[model samples]
Target: MLTCVTRGLFIQLVFDCRRLRKMQPQQPGYSSSRAYLELIADLPWQKVSEERELDLRAAKESLDRDHYGLTKVKQRIIEYLAVRKLKPDARGPVLCFVGPPGVGKTSLATSIAKALNRKFIRISLGGVKDEADIRGHRRTYIGSMPGRLIDGLKRVSVNNPVMLLDEIDKTGSDVRGDPASALLEVLDPEQNKTFNDHYLNVPFDLSKVVFVATANRMQPIPPALLDRMEVIELPGYTPEEKLKIAMKHLLPRVLEQHGLSSAYLQIPEAVVKLIIERYTREAGVRNLERNLAALARAAAVKVAELDSTLRLGKEMQPITTTLLDSRLADGGEVEMEVIPMGQDISNTYENPSPMIVDEAMLEKVLGPPRFDDREAADRVSSPGVSVGLVWTSFGGEVQFVEATAMAGKGDLHLTGQLGDVIKESAQLALTWVRARSADLNLSPTSDINILESRDIHIHFPAGAVPKDGPSAGVTLVTSLVSLFSNRKVRADTAMTGEMTLRGLVLPVGGVKDKVLAAHRYGIKRVILPERNLKDLAEIPAPILAGIEILLVKRIEEVLGHAFENGFPLRLHSSL
Candidate 1:
């Protein structure tokens, strides 16, 4: 019991109720505020830290030693972290790696975790549907767990941890805002400072957490959510890079895991390359790792099964091409007589050659190339069809641009899921061609005139897939010019650039991807805007060694060179 409101200077010193602790009712029927305060005090309060690193030097070393060939990707990562170091106030950059699966999105995330001393958590959202998956449920829901972001923090017991949100683009919107939208608060550097946890009932600063997101596509991302994050594209590994990664990391790990350790488990670089090119088709090493796992398991089982059949030796030996070839025909028709791999063998009794593999073995194992060397040439050549080199996260590919002018009502039609940017690009190309038609020795018919008299439609193939980006300008214009002028651009050449109505060609991005696409398509020559020549510095010397790169400032220069027969490009009034 306490008396609180009393005159103090009147020499009436009474018990100060404000200074007295609230007493828990000792009576039989007791209900008190003390019970509620006890519950609140007992609630778990976790201590957290925002910026923690494992070991920056070690992370860099691990990346260099673990993977091969993606020098650009590793370099980009360093630059990203460097920016973070420069601005410690900013949370670690939100990285969105756009690339084909298996190139090492998940692996690199782990490496980054180990490099930094902070805890690391990886969550896959490939098919996540519930917004509650990201934003925690209200405490009213029974047995509801905290959303991924909060749970990650509590488990790590730190404010800052590397939380890899895999496949953020796949995060969908439903009755509740998309899980991606929930990321708005957590990922936003401004609002995350007061990130309130429903259960904790206290605002916890979350700006310290480092968030990284990965996806195979960028188009699906909501603009509002995407604006808050930094996107880092992880490029696919080249064949050489794949082979080296296998030899350096995958093969040894598989062999050790399968109990075929030591030098005896050696897989030759050539065979590893063969496995990568034939058995796997991805930007990353996941496929190659799985294939290697299969091979290692198979080798272990084979050796175990063959133990009593043949005399054993104390020393383990590497499985040569001979043994690998023999295993390929293990349960097949070639069982009757072993096919020898190496050249030259003779015996008096028509000795069957022992099963061994060489270049010729590519056919038996992979069942002929999925594609042929002359596949490009085998395609039927059409009047306005032209090959365009375009780059994707999967590296580069040769894209075909087919222009067809059909007999229809006077109208301009375009199809093939072209995005706004690309659609605008096609229109620009058309305007450029119409203005310079006379110079290329073709009728200069504007779209308005053409629609009034004749109908024309242009399309980029592969309709099921959405296509955008503005690097297709030159391809469209060249195809149209070739069709009207009745000429053919070199079958082995590809071009990519943006064109203007005034006939002045402007530079576009994806120069490296375009060049790579050309190389992949067996094109000997490529045409890019002269301005993009600076981007060529990113190109590896080995990849671009034999290819011819032609930089053009004007569409007219491309006209004479791209077409088979040289025609003086008509000087447009604007030109």
Candidate 2:
């Protein structure tokens, strides 16, 4: 049976064909109407059926073969495929892969397409500010065309293609409209069955299409749009996983591209590890692949040079018997005649000297390491400085909070592009410190007088990068206490938690990311809110093993764990 849309389009095409037949051959409307009729005829009205069964085993193998270290993402895709196999007509939820760049989010989507035996289409939503770019411009406008969704279907000539909306978080909005808001109707499975494009002027069935979106961060995505999709997180790779990926996938491909074999150019395990640790630091192998390609190009040049030298007839002379005897005899005892014994060096060109990329070679090729944790460690080694862990869009990072006091009017200065929440946190921390100065051993005389006579300044480094959130509450308080009492915080310690007015440590989000950040910075100890202890389960065991995790319910407990000594003797006695 013909659907309403098909019935209407057929009727319209019949009328247009009759009108075009009557019109003159060279008339503009005649040719245009004929073309429109052909387009309407070619529209794919019927849904294509997958004759082959959904193969879970083959799908798993394909995903594993294409990508590495996205175990949870692969599992989720497999589960979806399994459910899909059981119920063919079920509409799957839209999957959004969230991670930093080069972590295989885009490639994973392609792998999904291959697994399901569907055509893949990619539409980058980055910098797409106009809503028309998504829903498409109306027919009333000049040069109007179908939206990306409809266009993708037309190009693939199928209804069940895997459509990837890459960089969804980067979609922009202005006076035109919100492109992200336009995606709400398209992403929601219930509404997408009759997905309407403005130019198409007909309801297109998008229920069968598998929509996957990728983003570096989730915060920029509209909440309504975010709610429609199931998010799968792909965190940064571990050193071991990175090395494996390089050896398994990247090395051979790079070798083949450079026209060199692994025998002629070898990258040892230690060298690959050095490349990962020093040359590039990212959650994915994009940069790692680039580094490997560079190494391959360098090796290719050496091979080319060796081949050129051999072709130029530059052969080494073999040592004569007289020369060997002269070398064996005493320095001034024998005289030897030097003669050229021609030995073709061309054979050596067949097996070029293997290029071994070590730590020193990596330095020469990729320049110095991008990050240095030692400088950060030394900066936070003194009193009035404390380390705070933060979660950013790129990934987790360690931020240093520094506080200093001087004799002046009782004014507190806050710098470092701190957000309002963080500024409020700093103020609250200062108030808490002032109120408890007597117990904290921060005041030699009256607490009020000590605070009133001094000016306190708190600053977070990296002044250009905006810092926010309530998570820095404990770190700020510790910095204040250390500044006032002349006690240094533990150099290897880091803390993250919100502070209440009554000295309670409140829970903060991103515990796993913050802990990972701390671990990356070589922090030996971490103080977190007791409520976030469950988040520790999400972190890997190896990362957790290196750090001492102290779950604290109150600010005093944080102080005890953060400082080198459990607090000052006087404060300890008072407690």
Instruction: Report per-prediction Cα RMSD to one decimal.
Output: 12.2, 7.3
Number of the top-ranking candidate, with TM-score as the measure:
2
Q: How well does candidate 2 match the true structure in TM-score terms?
A: 0.86
Q: Candidate 2, residues 425-461: lDDT per residue as tens digits?
A: 9999988887777777766633355577789999999
TM-scores of the models, in the order given = 0.73, 0.86
lDDT of 2 at 49: 37
Question: In candidate 2, which residue ranges exceed 4 Å CA deviation?
Answer: 1-6, 13-43, 47-51, 308-348, 406-408, 444-450, 569-575
Off by over 4 Å in 1: 1-44, 47-56, 69-92, 95-100, 127-130, 154-159, 217-227, 254-267, 271-357, 393-395, 444-459, 565-567, 571-575
Instruction: Estimate the lDDT of model 2.
Output: 0.82
Local distance difference test, each candidate: 0.67, 0.82
lDDT of 1 by residue, 1-575 (tens): 01211245112212222212444457421232333233223322344444554345666677888666667777777766666666766555677777767777777777666665568888888777777876666655555455677666656666567788888877777786677767788788889887765543345567766778888777788898888877776665656667777777887888888877543344567876667655665556786798677666655665555543343442448556876687677854443576776745433224133223344544444455454336455542656877786665555667788887767775668899888998888888777766555555575543234434667788777787667787788788888887887676678777888777766678876666667556545678888889988988877787678688889987777776687765565444445
Model 2 CA lDDT for position 178: 91
